[model samples]
Target: MLIKGFLDALQPEPILSVSQWADQNRLLDSKSSAMPGKYRTSITPFLKEIMDHLGEYSPVEEVIVMKGAQLGVTEAGINWIGYTIDVSPCPMLFVEPTKEVVELVSKTRIQPMLESSPSLAHKVKPPKSRDSGNTLTKKEFPGGILRLAGANSAAGLRNMPVKRLMLDEVDAYPVDLDTEGNPIDLAKKRTSTFAKRKIFILSTPVTKGLSVIEPLFESTDQRYFFLPCPHCGALQHLKWENLKYQYNKSSKVAKEVYYQCEHCQEGIQESEKTKMLESGVWIPTKPENQNKKRVGYHINSLYSPLGWKSWEDLAIEYEEAIGDVPKMKTFYNTSLGLTYEESGDKPQWEALYDRREDYPRGKIPTDEIAFLTAGVDIQKDRIELEIVGWCEGKVSYSIDYRVLMGFVAGDGSAQVWQKLDAVLNETWIRPDGTQMSIRMMCVDSGNWSSEVYAFCGRYPPSRVVPIKGRDNQITIISAPKAVNVTRKNKSVDGVKVWHVGVSLLKSELYGWLRVNPGDPGYCHFPMYDEAYFKGLTSEELITTKNKNGHTVQRWVKKFTRNEPLDIRNYARAAAHMVGMDSFSPKHWELMRNKRTGAVKNKVKKKSDFWN
Candidate 1:
């Protein structure tokens, strides 16, 4: 009768709501966070209603939160897990983008939640306890177990049935897992055995229609957190555009950021957000929201903590990102909680060709030139070269493109090599008769590796760099490494080859091609042959399943002859080598004055538009 005696001793406490329990017990520790304190629902009142849905009374089978970074989505999720452990223990699954995230969350979030809360600490045994079922990926309680896994692992998704499942950063999750149809569907199957199952999915959206969270949110009763203006007393949703301030062009900053009341036309300071959120309520556009078992909530960084991402902070970030394509994409996804829309396809070859400016092939106005870079594409029969002029805001002007006709006769002794040398040394005369030579040239080492190494070896590394196209996610260029197995496959001093991220540059270039002229990051097209535009627009980005059944994106050619695109990609890489990112305003003025040899009339700033 040991069990009976233990049951008698264990007194059943009064039932309390999840939020009520958290306010009375949950603690945030210094080990896991800087703001360590007891839990309070008032800090993020908008989430209390969402987290309480995990209780037995709520019928929501699914909850989707399309949120930005540092918005407490992860913390709210941990609260639900703790509530489950203390009140209604059941099998749960916590999934992240990868195995590393799973391990990280276990150590950072779950551990702190259990150790900091007395009720949860007493219910769940620690790792050292003899009967405590605690591990990095799995935790077993008296009646239930919590399992952790990455979306990439198929076996983990199918292993055990669960009553509660959470998928963090759902947009980053691989579209598929091995042969499993969909990771979401696979994870959903695990909860099928339990009649009362709860699943929570959250992420910052990726792209329109392709984002993992968008469709899920659209299908549910789409809900948004609406707050009443402190002055106007009128309820309205917080949006990025609602916040406004003066942008100082010279300083590259928004002077001040304050929300304008749409109804009263009064300014709302961020300091007042605390009170406004205290009176906030979530409104659902779909009336049948209560009827549906699934619900969705969307919130942006606008609702983040006061000191965390203030109105001015977000404003400055937007001002900086508006001029950069990749940064703008990130802003859309993270700051606004919106999906980035990729232009339908690479700019049509005809469109770019037809929009060619009056500028001659190689006579780009020196005033418009900030720096110059050249790309070389080596082929068995010939080599291709392209010179691109980069100005402020990354607006690149096509200077000239030429094809050298010859073959590699005997190890860098070909006429093609001589032509390439002449091209590299040739200076393009500007409108003012000032000459500008290529500052950096990238020669393709992927093909004709031995010959390319020999030709580039003849020149100093500062003048010519041997490069091969590679696919990377972070940046356009990777650190220089030993050339791919060469004639001897031996390392040479000062002989380093760069890996150009073809995929990264191609994506950025495509974005530039789509932006209208006069816009930041717009790429200028000079008078070029139809064939040149054809090759430039030859490839398009496509999403398809990889060998692991996971969805991936890459550029694929529609037809043949993509050398024009290749040269452009290489030129972009060369642009980085010549300080494309670090150039100061003084450098641009110096570059502009090189042609006329005129004393600086104006101290040009980085924000100045290209001439």
Candidate 2:
């Protein structure tokens, strides 16, 4: 009588279709059958609707379900398995990520559902006796056997021709399996021969990038369900961002916040939302028979009767404890199958994309380019130089490579300086017989400052620039004031070279240079060097302030180390060429007019001051 009453209440009205009526009936009673001499286990309306769909045995070859946690998705799967076993009795395989999870499911969830479900309990025979150590598989009256396998082991999934395959938490499966291959691919092979085979892939969404489960969800044959709004009568999907809340300060309580209708722009409270959802219907949005074997459903925690209190209570607790970001996002979007708008750290890869189109290998164009800069990354025994030649606003060519065996001590310091001098002189000459000197050659003065200084002194004045790398900002230290030394009837040349900070150069480059996608001019000597990029925190960079209370910006290095070669060299070279120095024409003229050769040693005198 109880089962009959529930069934009669569940029957569709004349105007409603079978699926529509089933949805209504399941929502009202929440139970389908009653068992004699056993405690009645109430079914959730959501699970009952799924069970009803299974009973129909539609031609749908697959069912995809997106569900909130603790909505008994696993339980529904088990019940469906039991139903299939009792009605049809075919080979079935249940695949999970690990053996431990399989064991837990088999012992706890599966066993209890079979024991408690009155419909399943009455149909299956009692357990048979076997050896104490080894347990025999339990068989219900129907001859179907349900086997459990772990995806982690390749040997476990071999040679299994199954009619139904239930893949739980497919997203969490390891990308590669020991011997069988990817767990998903291996499991699909098990059902290759069976034309009427049923496969169900279900999981909570993870990262947005493509993964194994994404292919199934992307298929057009799959179904996506949307609930209609009561006030505006618009079909809509639930999103975490739209949720609003009202708080009571004295009681420290929070209630379900209202959301403005996307269509009507009117506030819809939880009560109105419930009414609208109750009247809403879920139907197949795809065409009649294009990849028609698949079905997908996204379930939220709000749909579960028992889950309501927890959801409401958590919203209140989270608002008070840690703020709304995690609780609202994780619980609503991940735990529940709701959409969320993400706002946080932007990927550095996006910046890299802007220069992508400008980096293709092609013939170097001969034109009057405005800026020619070289960034040198220095090492103890070797140095790398990236020469960027820009024509108009586009990058013409970038030569990124290293020069080895330039060690100062190994090859006498003079010899090393001589080689660098040769390279610089070569860069200044144009292929068409004109002198195309680089506006700036940023030499790295980080580790070997003395050697760099020695080399700078030998070059023409105003030609070589000194650069310092600190934090993110590169500051060029200005040339010291030239002091007159006329004592003891002797004259000495003071240090007159300009010192440019790399941070200053980096600022200019970031501001003026537009690195389009594939820009060759945006070159790093050591490509994708993490040491220059990952050290500093974003918050530290953003919150940094100068002495005058303005935001102080610095370029993040692409590599890690006390002295980053690529960034340091690039900054120094660019700064020197951009004329970011205070120097007179006489300085360059005086140094250029001097004879170029190795310096000769002279006897020391009291008046020979090392100024």
Candidate 3:
């Protein structure tokens, strides 16, 4: 026994790549994985090369993968961690978007993976009551410690040096952590100390100009998996355009689905996918960068394993997402692993003016109008307001645009404010003879904020609300912040002020403006003059470098007057705050019933008139 032990110690450590190591020892816990058994690279053969590059023997410094959801990339990342702990035994760090997510992943995924694998379980002990090193966020093994951190926390990213760094869902990470800088840059600094370090970056990219992963992926060789056609043997990467399906027109369900080969024009069935995936090869689009230290791979849900996310499923999802911006964005980001490109260029004002519908300006044109909202823009000399009618599917109609020409400063502000109140309180009739009043009003407080707050505070908080525009906000409207209002230079009662993400709303509005009528998120206009169209399209989205030397998108005015755009943004915010964003079909039906019921009550029958 002593001789055998000595011989084992003398024998060189077995050389195994990350894939080989995972296939030999990694076990997927039943609690975490759908397929809870031994890990097999064959199941997701496309990931075998990606994992092998992360092995301890590889000289590649960085491996970046821009991928869609449920492509087994996360499991592949866990496999690398397992191999590092058992074989390489070096300090490693895993950064997630938030600390809460890190904790959740640690308890749900990392802990289960370690506890289920015998080789890993023997090395990394489970967290104990007294063991600080072996906890949810930190795991200690023979020669290395695994630290899980959040990209939002700068301290967590900078506190330690790590030989291997893995950033999962990097696009979800905060742009700047505690104002220190970009989280990716901060985390990358942690691996600079190691001579031969491995860095893995993975994410489903969010947007084209703003995505962190897309740019990183572009910097590498940009490898894509190419599979040979089952019939023609011609090799090509899968594309959404080549995917064809036959669906029932009435039911909108897929009847038949197949991938049309680019070369042979033959339809490949789903059954042939497994063999094709197994025989696939990764070819770099930019072959000159093949020798570069950083390598990148991009794969969409089209290549998702046989049992997961079939082509038929994607076809049906794409059909359902048509004409809807948010759903289509999800289909592009989460399914195709592609950035949803938003056209930032200025939409044509002439086209919008020419296409104005021949409808009355003051009344709702259609019974589809669910509710009404008003956006008030305060200027030094005048107040501009637009009454907008909103319906399901984010279809909006411009009901009225009024320019209250009165001194909106000091004592004269009261006249314009009172005029705005009169307009807001006014009832507009729909074509069905049902009356509708402004459900919500968002008044701009950026200019003459105190006066705006005082004016908005006059009404109930539900009706009129003050809003401030923020360029950096992620959502269109966040929770309102209470602010103390001042009257006569003395503090009055506090009022709720909502922060509007103007940039996001503007992007949405621009996209909506480009869409034709009858499409989801389409914007309809009355017979307004050319000036209104010009004001609506006054600003152009431009990409410029910030003071921090990072590229940032900004909306710059091409014309002097942009109150139309600002007012529309506020109206969008008001709709969001009123829960229109989450309103169900039942809510819309209830609103319609209320409007129709009120109309019915106004009319008296011939028998009731005598009584």
Candidate 4:
């Protein structure tokens, strides 16, 4: 009794107002206790960390958080919602990916917190009537109501007028719904009226291209907390490369370390990281005007009070389990607050850039140019057409790209003929009155053979041809042959015309296409697929004998596996067919000399013949 009285006396009498004492008692009672039937339970540290941030209201309009799995981020969000309801009441919407998640979160995380937290439970009253399908309005505190909706339903999100929007697991939200708009965009409309609205988009990283969370992260005002280096007191980003083992020679694995100071070159250990935490800083260095007033937090299980010790133990266990690689990159990035590149895949960008210069634009030769051919790969809805103008000693320029839509009619037979006729009318125009048309246009008749045949009937005997190949062995239906045409009676413009086979046109194109490295004009063809250049593998060009004992030299793709679109092969085949030369003599000689055991042979074939 004496000690209690002394402690009370020391507490500055006037400072202990009824409200201040009540607030302290409320906070003390809220701490978790082992006693049964204790209404006030202590909030978890993870939740407390988030609550602390919310406790300080700033001008920041949004918070963008990137988190690892199971760090109570959802629970933290729930607490924030409840806190807002108690203190600053506004119409808020909680959005989840599906109806199931919405129901689960409301029942499990939100309801329990409001019921248990004495301060919050006292402020917000119960719902008027519990059974409303479209609206579940609970008058918890006084000023406003909290609305819950699933992003999965467009009508549910679209109708709400929300001041604060919490989009949960945005990465999981469906990008495109046939009848409804994108869920994220639909949710954003709910808060369009409120200028001082708060928006929180939180999600774990998913595969690169499609995830909706990417846009929020790219925003200017989104602040990422940067930790300073304890060793040198420099502000630096935590990266995976900075962390290394204590002994480089003895240890094969890298230890958990922070980036060294750029000036001092000293490593920042995890134990000393507490000094570096800057609570409110934007990431990626955004411009002042474009900033959205945001803060980001990366949460990991290591920060959880429940699993704190377990995290340390698991780190040791994981070191033994797989040498060094974590189950997912999120494990390292989230726990250590560092960034890492996605592992295990080779990027296709490099291969495309390597051969970028090889394909260039050039003038169409007047005298030596023999024929033009088009290779059409037709699909059900779309068609990929590559048109090659063939000359004897030049690289073929892809002059036209046509992407056509609409369904084909009559089992695609009539449609193919119509498309072929349209293509001929649009592309095959002669300067003179003579019918200057492609010698032959090859259609991938693999899927629609009958359609190809029907289309071919519209042209002269050898003008339209079908390509035949199974398992990458492509061959023209008719070999290269010439058809003579002469005017019966000679007139001023009357002249003889010759129709050539598809193979003859291909042969002409092959010689004409040449790789000129120095000329930018010939190097700037943008239509070529970048993936084709990247996937090219070094292979042995072999001469093999056919069944008839004829030696045929074939340049085979040498990769261990085959890619869906072998651009190099297609380009080479297109070049071969159109008589486009691979490169000039000087360039070819340099390449030949650079390669080991490369032989230069001058034996001219039909494909190599000029005019």
- lDDT top scorer: 3
Q: Top TM-score: which candidate number?
A: 3
Please write out the lDDT profile of model 1 over residues 359-384, one tens digit for every residue. 77877754677668889998888888
- The 0-to-1 C-alpha lDDT of every candidate, in the order given, reads 0.80, 0.50, 0.84, 0.46
Rank candidates, TM-score, best first: 3, 1, 2, 4
Q: lDDT per residue, candidate 4, 156-196, as tens digits?
A: 67775888888888766755443566777777788889877
Which ranges of candidate 2 are over 4 A from the true structure?
A: 1-56, 122-128, 131-141, 232-234, 247-252, 272-277, 284-290, 306-329, 338-611
Work out the TM-score per prediction.
Answer: 0.74, 0.47, 0.80, 0.44
Model 4 deviation from the true structure expressed as Cα RMSD, one decimal place: 21.5
Weakest ten-residue segment in model 1 by summed lDDT: 602-611
lDDT of 3 by residue, 454-547 (tens): 7776666778889999865556776788888655555535578989978767878888998877787899999998888888989987777766
Report residue 437 deviation for candidate 3 (angstroms). 4.2
What is the number of backbone collisions in each predicted candidate, taken in the order shown? 0, 38, 0, 42
User: In model 3, what are the clashing residue pairs, if there are any?
Assistant: none
Q: Return the TM-score for candidate 1, rounded to 2 decimals.
A: 0.74
Residue 38's lDDT in candidate 3 = 95
Model 3: runs farther than 4 Å from truth?
1-9, 24-31, 115-128, 134-137, 174-180, 247-250, 354-361, 374-385, 402-427, 437-504, 516-520, 527-531, 547-549, 573-611
lDDT of 1 at 320: 79
Q: In candidate 1, which residue ranges exceed 4 Å CA deviation?
A: 1-11, 118-135, 289-292, 345-351, 354-389, 399-511, 514-519, 524-528, 539-559, 566-611
Local error of candidate 4 at residue 8 (angstroms): 26
The predictions' CA RMSDs to the true structure, in order, are: 8.2, 22.3, 7.0, 21.5
Q: Write the per-residue lDDT of candidate 2 for residues 232-252, one digit (tens) a residue.
A: 678766554455677785476
Q: lDDT of candidate 1 vs native? A: 0.80
